[model samples]
Target: MIELQGVHKAFGPKRVLNGIDLTVPTGESMVIIGGSGTGKSVLIKCILGLIRHDAGQILLDGEDVTKAERDAFLARFGMLFQGGALFDSLTVWQNVAFRLLRGSLKRPKDEAREIAIEKLRRVGLKPDVADLFPAELSGGMQKRVGLARAIAAEPEIIFFDEPTTGLDPIMSGVINDLIREIVVEMGATAMTITHDMTSVRAIADKVAMLHDGVIQWTGPVSQLDESGDPYLDQFIHGRAEGPIEAVR
Candidate 1:
């Protein structure tokens, strides 16, 4: 569903993504694992056209993303940000229904709220919680609300940016299971960027390791531990030493 070919990006003297060739198949989950500053987020931004790449191509369904019509192109995607990124002023239901309340996907107020409530339920939240503000919810609850919002618009593609950030192990596990289940249930093409090995293991159908501004290794999740790339080995096992030098 998505493909990147010889992609390159940089900020003045610093290069981020270089020759990042990868693909995410339709209705499957691809998790990108990398050390901090490896440009995983930048690659996603480049694909979304949030940041223009210096060279090469990002294709969504065989068409170049840079040339696609902005509105219709973006409408096909949903994103769960690294931070919960909820509007503190808006109530949970309103936040979930943000897309449905405006732009091309707008719906009647009543219908939007109903869909919001249903999505909240799907993410394991009760109906009463919908009226509360984001501040009233716990971290995990906030994340669940974000997930509900991501799926509320029924996007064909979903991008999860560190889905389990800032949660306890149990809550992280819950979010991982929810992400895996929801992606499969909705059959949405999924691309996630996270350093968390546990999240990678739980949510990925395929794993790609990003290092030194390129895809160092990519293959089925089932073959992760046996892939035998030093960069990937050091990353997935959390080693302090390898090709990746830990900053002191």
Candidate 2:
């Protein structure tokens, strides 16, 4: 449903993305695994049109959406940012219903609140929690609220950045399971970027590794261990001494 062809991006003197080619089919979950400063986040920003690529085509549903009709195109996606990115001033319900309250996709307040509560429930949050502020919730709860917001509109496509970062293993598992469940329930095309191996195993249908601003490997999740690519091996196994450079 989404495709990037020959994408390239640069920031002044530094070129972060070089010839990126990727595709996420409808209803499939693709996870990007890479080390810090490998341009993984840049790749995702390009997809969202937050960071325009210097050259290349971004096609959504067989149409070029790089500069034209971007608004209409972007509304199709829901994103859970790396840090949850919630509005501190807004209550939990308002945060989840932000898109629904003001946008071309806007819904009435009563309806929006109902949808927000339902979405919260979908992510295992009780309705009572919707009245609480973000600061009142734990990190995991905040992440769950972010998840609820992302799917509140039942978007056709979703982007999850570092979905399992900064959480304990058990909490990470809960969030991962919620992500997997919602993605499947919505049948939405999903893309996640994360370094956690547990997240990869839980959320990815396909895996792509980014190294040196290029895709080092792309394959099914089940084939990751047997890909015979040293880069994939080094990453998934967390091997310190390999082709992927790491300094002690």
Candidate 3:
């Protein structure tokens, strides 16, 4: 449901993305794997129109996103940022229902809270936790709350940035499974960028490896091990010696 053709972005003298061509089909989870400073986050920001591309086109459902109405276009998607990004001032339910209580998607406070509570349940959070503030929760709980908020609006598309970044192995696994389940249950197109191989294995239907601002490999997750690409080999195995330079 999303496509990028010859996408290029540069910041001053540095070229961050160079002709990135990628696609995420409807109802599929596409995970992007790359080392730090390889432009993975920049690629997603380009697609989301947060960082406008210098050239090329980004199409969402066959229409150019650049020309679409900003608010209406953004409403079709949800995002879970790298750090869980919950509001310190808002309670759990209020944070989850942030979008629902504002803008074109606004609903009555009671209705929004009810939906928020239901989504929290979906992400394995109890209703009792809804009244607590973000600071009152553990890192994993905060991540779950972030996931609940992402799906609270029932978006057609979702973007997850480094979903398993700071969690322990067990909590990472939990979050990964929750992401996979929610994406499938909602049947929403998903694009995730993460360096965590375990998260990729658990959450990706398709995988794409980015290197030097370009896609080095793109295929089904099942093919990742046998893809025979040097870059993919180095990344998935965490090998220090490969075609990909460790020095960046």
Show pairs that collide, candidate 1. Answer: none
Residue range 19-106, candidate 2, lDDT tens digits = 8888889999999999988899899898888887899888888888775586677788899998899999999999999989998989
Q: How well is each residue in 76-119 modelled by candidate 3, as lDDT tens digits?
A: 99999888999999999999999999999999999999999999
In model 3, which range of ten residues has the least summed lDDT? Answer: 239-248
Model 3 segments more than 4 A misplaced: none
Clashes of each: 0, 0, 0
> If both were scored by TM-score, which would come out higher, candidate 1 or candidate 2?
1
Q: How many backbone clashes does candidate 2 have?
A: 0
Question: Residue 204 error for model 1, in Å?
Answer: 0.4
Per-candidate Cα lDDT values, in order, are 0.95, 0.91, 0.94
In order of appearance, the predictions have TM-scores of: 0.98, 0.97, 0.98
Model 1 stretches astray by more than 4 angstroms = none
lDDT of 2: 0.91
Error of 3 at 99 (Å): 0.8
